[model samples]
Target chain A: MSRSARSFAVAGAVLLAFTGLASADAVKLGRPALPEEIKAWDIDVRPDGLGLPEGQGSVSQGEELFQNNCAACHGEFGEGVGRWPVLAGGQGTLTSERPEKTIGSFWPDTSTVFDYVHRAMPFGAAQTLQPDEVYAIVAYLLYLNDVVPDDYVLTKENFPTVALPNRPNFYDDDRETTEKAFWKATPCMKDCKPKVEITSHAAVLDVTPDAGKEGDKPAGAVE
Target chain B: MNQMKPGSRVDRRRFLTLAGLAGACAAVGVQPAAAEATPDPDIVNLPPWTQALGAGVNNHPYGVPSPFEKDVVRREVTWLTASSESSVSFTPLYALDGIITPNGLCFVRHHGGEAEIDPTRHRFMIHGLVDKPLVFTMEDIKRMPGRTNRVYFLECAANSGMEWRGAQLNGCQYTHGMIHNVVYTGVPLRAFLEAAGVKPKGKWVLAEGADASAMTRSIPLEKAMDDCLVAWAMNGEALRPEQGYPLRLVVPGWEGNMWIKWLRRIEVGDQPWGQREETSKYTDLLADGRSRRFTFIMDAKSVVTSPSPQAPLHARGPNVISGVAWSGRGTVTRVDVTLDGGKNWTTARIEGPALPRSMTRFYLDVDWNGEELLLQSRAMDDTGYVQPTKAELRAVRGVNSIYHNNGIQTWLVRSNGEAENVEVS
Candidate 1:
C-alpha cells in the first residue's frame, strides 16, 4: 500500500474501533486506462528522443507555417510581440544586463523546441500541429537562429544532433550546499539590527498601478 | 475604519480611565460610529436594512459576497502582463481574514491563457516507462481507491517576483498575492503510478496540462512518489473553471506553476525532459551569468495583510494586526512581528491548524499610538529556516532573478494612517 493509503487505513481502523458500528463506505474503483487513449494524450518528447513521433520536414515548409501561425505573436524573425516569448536569437547574451534567453542562446536540448512546438505553439491554438508540421516549425526556428543551413531538413534521426549553444550553462540545483546559512536554528530577535534605513518605495519605481482608481471597474462586478 | 473623532483621541484616555456611562449607550445598541457621531434628524429614523425585509434564500443559487464587498475581488495590475487572457489577477489579501482563501477569492495565473475544458471529453493519460500505459476519463479517475483531505499552500515561484528588483508594488495583494491554500480531495499520484506499474528505470515524470500553453514540468520520481496528488475537488466543491475544473496536480511545497491545471498527461521517463518552463522561463539567472534550473521549492515567507496600502487603519486604539505565514518545506512553528522595523521582534500568536505545507494565521493585537510605524512579519518553520530580509536575499541571489523572493516585506504606516510599500536596510 502507498504511504497515504497506509495512513488512511490506520485512521479508518481507529474510527471503526471507536464506533463499533462497522461503516462500509470503502469502495475500490476506476478501470484500466486504454492504450488508444494513452497514445492520443502521451505527446511529451524527452531529450533522448524517447517520445519524438516519426516525422520529417524541410526549413522552407517550416518558414511558411511560422509566418501563417506564429508571426503574429512571435515577430517575423522570432523577436516576440507584446509579451509573448521570443523563440530565436539572443546568442552570447547570457551575461548581459538584460539577458534575452531564446532557443539559440539558453535552451539546451532540441527536443524542447520540438515538444513545445508540437504541443503548444501558436498560443491560443495548441496541439493542432501534426508531427511533420512540428518538425518543420522546429527546423524553421533553427534556421532563424542560424543553427541550420537553408537546405536543412529535420527528421527524427537528425533531431538529436541539433544542440543549443548554451547547453553547458545549466546545472542541477545546489541550494543545500550553496544556501546552508539560510537554515538557521535560532535567528537574532532583539536589536538584531541597530538601525534599518528606508531603502526604496513602490511609488518611486511607479510600476504598480494607482490603488484607488475606481474609473476602471472590474468586468464582472459582483455587486 | 472606526477611528475616534478628532477631539476624542484625548477622550480615549478618559474613556479608558473612567469606564464611564457612555458604556451604557453601547449596552443599549450602537455601532462604533453611533458611539460618537452626532445623529441627523432625517437619518435617525431608520436605515434601509432596518426599514425593509431582506431578500430570501436562493436569491443566488450559489451565493456571492455582500454588495458592500464589491471591491473585495481579485484585481490585476494593468502593467503586469500583455493581455488579460494570458495574465494573473492577485487575491485581495488585505481584505481577507484568517488563512483559508475562499474559492472565489483565490488568485488566477495562466500562461497561454485560461481554458474552458469540457470534462466529458477530457482524458488523462499515463504513458512511457510503465508496465501498463493507461488513460482515464474524469469519472474513471474520481472512482479511485482513496480520497484524502490535505491542506497545502500553492505559491507561485514568482509570488513576489517584482520585489527582487525593489519594492515595486504598493499593496500586499500585488506583492504577495500569487498564492492560495485549500483542502484537496483526490488520490495519491503514486497509487495510480503503482497501478500502472512504473518501470524501475523511470527516473522522472513529465506532467503536462491541457491549456493553450500545454504547460509541462518534469518531477523527479522520488518527489512524485512522495507527496504529489492528482486532485479534482478543491475546498469541497468541484474545482473552479479558473482552477482547472476537471483535474489538476497538487504538488505540495513546490512552485505553483508545477501544479499543472487542466492536467491531461503524465509520462514516466528515464531523464529530465528539460522543458521550456524549467529552462527559459522559470530558471534563475545568477549574478555571475550562470542560471539555476529547476529551483522548485518555494522558500519560507510571510506578510502583514491588514494595515497594508489598501486596508489602512482608521481607528488607532486597540486593533488586531493579522497576517499569514507559511513554508513550503514544513509547518510554520513561529511568526514574529516587528512594530519598529527590524529593531525589536515579538512572537505573534499563531491561530488555526499548523499543518505541514499549509498557511498559518498569526495575529498581534496592539495599542497603536498613531505614530509612524514600520510594520513587518518574520516566519520560522519546522526546518529552522527563518525568513530572511530583502537585503540578505538580494546579497546572495542578486536582483536579476525575478522569482522565489521569500524576503521580509516592510509596510510604512504614516501618522495619518496610510501605509505604503517600502524596503528597509
Candidate 2:
C-alpha cells in the first residue's frame, strides 16, 4: 500500500477507536500490577507512617548496623565524612554562624532517618537488607543523635512515636508578605540599572567546528 | 592578544588559583587514569576539596561531586533566611555540562527533611478514583517496557530565590546553581494512568514520596498526560539515592517539588489536593500582598559561569565568559552578555545544540583591560521572553519571598581580576 493510504487507514482506525471503542477496550489492554510485585518495590515509609515495614531492631543493633554500613560516609558518630552530610553533631547550632544540622540537631522528623536508611544507605549496595536491618539502622542513627535511648529498639509498631529534634522549627510560608514587597508590578521599562557595556571579550575554548587553534592542545599531552 | 607586564596583580591571582597545578608539574610521574577524548584527571584518587569518605560501607551507593568541583557546588547565605535548613541552595548551572548532574552534585532543598527508604521491599499503590485501585512493584514497573529520553534540566522555583533582593552570594554557583539537566528512563505517566484505569472524572493526581515526611503534591491530570514521567533512572543508571533512587516523579519544566522523589504512591482525584508543598510552599507572592497560588511554570533565566565570582577572572587579556541558560516555558533563543552592568548588550555566541527544557551554553569573547566592569547575562527564550533584571523582578514580585527569582545576575570584576556578586541599581 502507498504510505499515504496506510496513514489514512491508521487514522481511520484511531478515529473509530476514539469515538466508540477507546474507553471500553482500553481497560483490557494493560494488566493489573501484581501485589507481590508491588511489595518487592514499594519501600517508602511515609511521614504519616503508612508504609513502615514489619521488622524491628534495637539501638544496639542499629549502632552495629550503622558502623558496619553507614559510619564510613556519615562518620562514626554521624559527623559526616568530609563534604558528606553531617548526621549527628549539628544539635542546637541552627542559629550559630555555622549550623551543624545533624539528624539530632536539624532533621525535623524521626521517620526521615528510617526512610533514608532503608531506601538508599550503604551507598553502593542499595536494597540488599531486610526490614529489620533498616529498623536497627534507624535505631542506631537515633541513638547516635541522642534522640533515642541506646537500648531502644525501633520497630514498625512504635515507629511513629519517635520525634525528630527540630520538629517544631518548620513552618509554611504563603509568600503574601513577600509578594507585596516584590514580584507584583510590571517590570522596569526604561534605562534599568547601569546599562551593561562590554569592554573586552575573550575566547575560553575553541571546541566549536573543531578549529585547529594553537592553544587548543588536548589535555594530558606533554607540554 | 594584549600582553601584560610582569608582576601585575591579575597574573598573581592566576598563579594562586593554579597553585595546585604546581603539584601536577612535580608529579609529572602521575599517570592519566583514563584516555578518553581528553586525558581524564585522576579524579578518583585525589582528595575532593570538600567531602571526606562517608561512614560505613553505606557511604554512597552513588558518589557525589568531586572536591575540585566543590567551588562549583551549591551555596546559601544565612541572612537569606533564619535557618539554613529552611533556606535555599543554588546549583552551579554555569560550571556544569552535558545533561547529567552527578548524583553527588545535584542540588537539594527540603521543607521537612530528606527521607531514607529501602527499595528491596518497596511498593506503590494507586487508589482513590481509579477503576482498578491497583498497586505496583518496582520489579513489575521495570519489567514493563519503558522509554528512555535524553531530555535535560530540572530546576527549583527558588533557584534564584535569593537574587530577587540582591546578588547575595559571591558566585554563579550560588546565584543560578539550582537547576540541572539529564536524560531519564522511566514509564510514562500516561501509560501508568491508562493501565491503572482512571475514572471518568479524574482530573488531578496526588503524588507522595515514601521518606519519613511522605512529601506529597497535587498535579493536574492534563499536565500528567502531557509529559509527566515516573522516572527510575537518570543518565542511564538507577536513580541516585539523593535524587530519589528506585522511583521519582519527573515533571519537566515545572518546579522541583512536583517532581517527587522517593516516590511512594499516586492517588487519583477530581480536585487539587492542596498539600503543604503546593499551598504553604512553592506558591508565588504578588506585589499587592496577594499570593499567586499554583504558579506552575518557571521563567527564562541565565548566568555567566566563567569569570564568575567563584570561578573568577584569571587574566585581563582574552577571556571566554561562558554560562548556562534555560526556560521552562520553552527553548532559549538568545543570551545577551553585558560587561558594563546592563547597559549595552552584546549577543553571545550560543554554542552546543539547544534542546527544549535543557541547559544551553552561551559564550562571549572579550578582552579585558584590567579595569573594573560589571558582568551580567540576560537570556531570551523561544517564546520571546527576556530574563528580567533584579529591580524589575522586585517591582513585580516584592522582596519578602525567597522563591522563583529569575532576575538577571551581576558580577563585579575588579581591576585585580577578582569577581564578586554585586547588585546594579
Candidate 3:
C-alpha cells in the first residue's frame, strides 16, 4: 500500500479505539496555579497602568541606578555605547536619512519602559531589580529624554499621565490600502523596463563577512 | 611492465597526469580518443576507505554532517550587534537544498542568549484572565490530549533590513538567511488554553520567555486559537538549546519575534501589553515620520540561492538555477524567474510539496552562452500577494522602515562564472 493509504489505515484503527473516550474539551492534566505562582510570573504591564506596582522613585535616585546598572551599554545620559540601544535624545530625526529611534523619540508608551526594565533590563542580570529600582530607572530615562523635570518623583498614580510624544504617530498596519497598486494579479512579464542600469553593488561596500577564512570556526560560535 | 608498486613515485606521477587529462576532457565534454592509454586513476586505484573497514554502527551516537561540508554553517556579522548573546546568525542558504532546513544549520536569533534548562524542573504557567490559572510540568504537558505535528517557516522581520537602501550583503546567506522551515511536534496552543478555560474578556495573550531577557510579545487570542503550537520538538528531535530546548511558542504565519523561545508563561488579558519590542523595535517607521505598528505577517519573498555570491557558477553550458520561495500568509503558488533583468520572465518549476506557511523550493534550467546576466525571482502566494521590487517597496515603505523588506533580490552573474549582489534600475 502507499504511504497515505497506510497512514489512513492506522488512523482508522486509532479512531475506532478512541471513539467513546475522545472529546473536544480539555483533558485537565495540569494542577491549578497557586496565587503566589501567578503573582510571581504575571509581570506584564499594559498601557492603561494595569499591572504597575505601588511604588515611588525620584530622578536623583534613578540617575544613580541608571549609572550603576545600565550605563555600561546605554551610556550615562542614555546616548548608547557601541551599537547598544540609545534610550534618549532623538527628538525630531525620524524623517531624516538616519532616524535614531530612542525610547524618548520613537516609543509609544511609558508602561513599556517600566515593564521592560522590570522584566528584562540590566542585560545579563534580569529580574533582579526591585519595583522601586525599576521606577527610578524609568524616571531617569524620562529626565534624559527631557520629558520630566530632574526633581520629578514618579509614582504609580502619575504613571498613566506620562505619555510618549510618538504615541500619536503610530497607526495600525495599512499595507493593504497603501500598497494596493503594487499587488498586480498579472504583473509585468515582458519589457517591464526599457533598459536596466546597475545602481549599487555589495562588492563595492565589502561588508559581508569572509566565510572562507572562518569556515573552521563558524561565526557567532557561542562560548 | 616493470612491475611498479602501486604506492611508488612513478605510479603517483602517472596517476596525477592521467587525472588532470581526465578532468580536462570532462570540463569540455570530450572523450579521450585512447581510453586504455590513460585509465581514470579514481576508478582504477582503490582509496584508503575502500581498502580498510569502516567504523562500527554506533561510531557516533549522534551523527553529524560529513567533514567535507564544513563550510555549511550559521554565520554572523559581528558589527550588527553589541554582543553575541543578543545577536543573530544567518543560515548558509547557498549550500542548502530542499524545503527542510537541517536542525543544526537553522539560523538562531537570541535576545539574552541560549538558556540551558533542566526539563524536569521547568514549569509552564497560564494565568491572568483564565477561569483556572494553571501550571504544568513537562510530563503533564506531554500527557495532554490533542497532540499534533505541523510544518512552518519562521522568519525574522529584519531578515533583509540591511538592504533597505541598497545591496549591502554579497551573499543570500547574509541578506536573506534569517529564516528556517521545520516540522514541529507539539500540542495545539488551543488545547492548553481550553484546559485553562479562557475568560470571556480575554482578547489577547502575552507569551513570555524564561531567558534572561524574558522576551515577551502580545498575541491576539484569535491567532492563538487558530494555529499556534506550544512546540517542544523540531525536525523530529528535542529542540536545540539555542532554539529554546525545553519549550517554545510557535506563532505560525507571523514574524519570528512573536515565537518566544524558552517559553514559560502565558497571561491572557483584554489589551495588548505594549512591550519594548512592539513599541520601539519591531514597528516600521515610514519616510513621513509616522510608524506602522503590529505588522506581523512577512510578505511573499524569494531568492536565488545557488549562483549567489557564495555559490558562484563554476562551469559554462547548461546550469540549474535553484532557489527558495515562501510566504507567511499562505502557500507559495508560483515563482517566476528573470534572466536579463526584468525584460523577460519565465515560470520556474516548483519542486517538492508546496505546503502553506512553508518554504517552497524552485528550479529553472537554462543554457548559458557565457554572457552577463541579471538574475531575479518573484514569488506569488495563495493570498494573491506578489513580491514587489526594491524600488516599489521603497516608494511605499521608504528606507527608514528597517523591517519587513520582502523586496525581490537581484544577483548579477558575469561571463567568468562569478556572481555578486546588485540592485538594478
Candidate 4:
C-alpha cells in the first residue's frame, strides 16, 4: 500500500477507537427535571418580553413601594444614596468624564431592569418581591428617568414598548477589529523612545489601604 | 573517624586542640567565655525549636499555614464599595512564588455574600430549549462520566481596573491580584448538555447562582458546549465556601463573573438573555459614549510581582526578578522583561508548565549595583496577541472602560532597594 494510504488507514483506526470509547462511556446520569422546579429557578428575562409574568402596576403604587423598599439605597428619586447605584436619570452623560450609568441612561432593555429587580434587588433581601411589585417599582423608575408620565401604568402588554435612551448605543464587542492596530507581532525592543519619565505615582494618591492596619475590620469587610 | 562511646573520655590531642584555640582567643584580648565573644551565637548555641518537640499529626484535623506565615493572607481594600458583603478581597500575590494560588489565599469577589450551602440539599437544573430538562443532585453529578481536570486562571474582568487612569494601587497584590489560577476537577458541561440534547434553536445559556444575589450571566451556547465545566473541586480539595463550595460553572478564559459560583440553574435559550450584568454593568463604555457588550475574553496580560511596592528589594548584589503572565486566548509563548522602562528589553526565562488559559511564571536574574531601575514585563500568547502598554490601551479603549485592563505594568525600583508603583511615559 502507498504511504498516504497507510496514513489514512491509521487515522481511520483512531477514529473508530474514539467512537467505540464514546459509546462505552455514555452512561447518562441525571433524571428529568420537574416543570415546577424549572419554573421556580429559571427566572431570566430576555429583551423581547419573553419571560414576563402577567401583571400590571401604576407609577403611584410604585412610588410607595420604592420609598419603602428601595429609597434607603436607591434614593427617593433614584438619584442614589451613599455609594449605592443610582437607578434613574443621567440622560445624556454617557460621553462625560464620569458618566452616571443609571437604568435610564445606560441600560439597553426594560427586561433587564425587571429581571435584575426580580432576581437580585432589595439588597440583602432578594427574590422576595412579587411580580406586580416589580412592575410597580419599574414604573416609578421610568417616571424618575423621565421616560414615562407619573400616571403611567406598566403592564405585561406594554413592557416591550418602553424603550431606553441608551438602547441604540450598545453594540457587540469589536476589540478584534477596532483595536486590531494595537496588536503588534514584533513590538519595538530597544530605544523605542528617546526618553522616559514618571508620569504618575500611586504613593501620591495615598489611597492604598495600609498593610499594617489590616486587622479584623479590613477594607471591604463583609458585615 | 570512629564512633565514640557514651562514657568515653576525650583524647589528649583533642583536649590540646581545644585548649590551644581558647589560648588563641585569650591572646587576642577577647574573653572566650563571654557571650559577645562567641562571634555567631546561632551556630554556638542550639535554638529552642531544636530542643523541643513539634505538634503531633492531625493537630489540626485540616492543615493551615504556620503562625510565622500569618502575614501572608488575602486582604481587602474596604473603601472600594459600599458594603462589605458585596465586595472583593485581593490575593496576596507578592508573597506567593509559583503559578498555583493556595485555596485559602485565592481572591474572593461576592455580589451578595458567601452563601453557606448544604451540598446534600443543593440541586442543579438544566432546562429550557432542550429535549429533556434534567435535575442533578450533587451525587448524580459526581457519578457522571467524562470527568476531566483542567488548569486555568479565573480573572475578574475588572482586574487592574484602578490602574487604567494611572498607577492607582501601590502593590501588585492590589493592582494585579484579582485573579487565581487553579486546576478544576469536574465533568465537561458537554456531558450534561449532550444528555439533555440541546435543540437546534438553543443559541445561549443563562447560568444562575443560588446565592441571595442569584447572580446571572448569559453565555453563548457555542462557548457553553465548547470548554465550560460543571466544576465541583479546585486544586485538590472541594471548592472553598468563598469560591462556590459545592459547585460552580468554569467558563474557562472568560471573565470571572460569568463563572457563577454556587451555580444552580442553566436555562438554554434561542438568544442572549440581555441580563443586567451583560447590559449595564460588565459592558465597556467606549470614549465615543457607545458601549461594547459581551466583551468576555480577558486579553493577554502580565505583571512583575517581586520588586513591586509591597515586595521591595532587600539587598543590592544579586536579585531574581519574578512575575506571572497569562492569556485568555491561548498559552503564553513569550514574556519580555525590561529594566530601563521600554528603552531596553530582554527575554525572561519561563519556568514550569505553560498551559493554555493558565498562569505562566517567568524570571529574570540580574546583578545589581544599587542603581535605580524601572522594570516592566510584556507577554505574548500563541494567538500572536501581544500585551499592549498603558498608553497604547488608553489610546484605543480610554480609561473610562473600567473592565478588561490588561495593559503592561511598570514598577520603579530606586537606589535604596525600595520599589514604588509608577507610570513611566
Each model's TM-score for chain A is 0.79, 0.71, 0.85, 0.83
Q: List candidate 4 stretches off by more than 4 Å.
A: A1-25, A211-223, B1-38
Ranking, lDDT, top scorer first: 3, 4, 1, 2
Question: For candidate 3, lDDT tens digit of each residue in B1-425?
Answer: 11111111225456555445444433543344785568779889999899999989898899988889999999998878889999999999999999999999899999898999999988999888899988999998887777889999999999988898798888999999999999999988898889889999999999999998999999999999999999899999999999998999999889999999999999999999999888888899999999999999888999999889999887654467899999998999989888877877888889999999999999986545556789999999987899999999999988888899999999999867789999999
Residue pairs in steric clash, candidate 4?
A219-B78, A220-B78
DockQ result, candidate 1:
0.35
Tens-place lDDT per residue, model 2, B331-415, is 9888877776765566787887788888788877654556577777888887667787777677765664456788777777777
Q: Model 4: which docking level applies? A: acceptable
lDDT of 4 by residue, B331-415 (tens): 9998998888888787888899999999999988665555578889999999889999999899988777889999989899986
Candidate whose lDDT is highest = 3
Q: Give DockQ per model, in order.
A: 0.35, 0.05, 0.46, 0.39
Quantify all predictions' global Cα lDDT against the true fold. 0.81, 0.66, 0.87, 0.86
Q: Kindly report which residue stretches of model 1 are placed more than 4 angstroms away from their true locations once superposed.
A: A1-28, A211-223, B1-44
Clashes of each: 1, 76, 0, 2
Q: Is the docking of candidate 3 incorrect, acceptable, medium or high quality?
A: acceptable
DockQ of 4: 0.39
Q: Which of the two candidates, 2 or 3, achieves a greater lDDT against the reference?
A: 3
Residue ranges of candidate 2 with Cα displaced over 4 Å: A1-223, B1-90, B111-113
| TM-score of each predicted structure versus truth | 0.87, 0.59, 0.91, 0.89
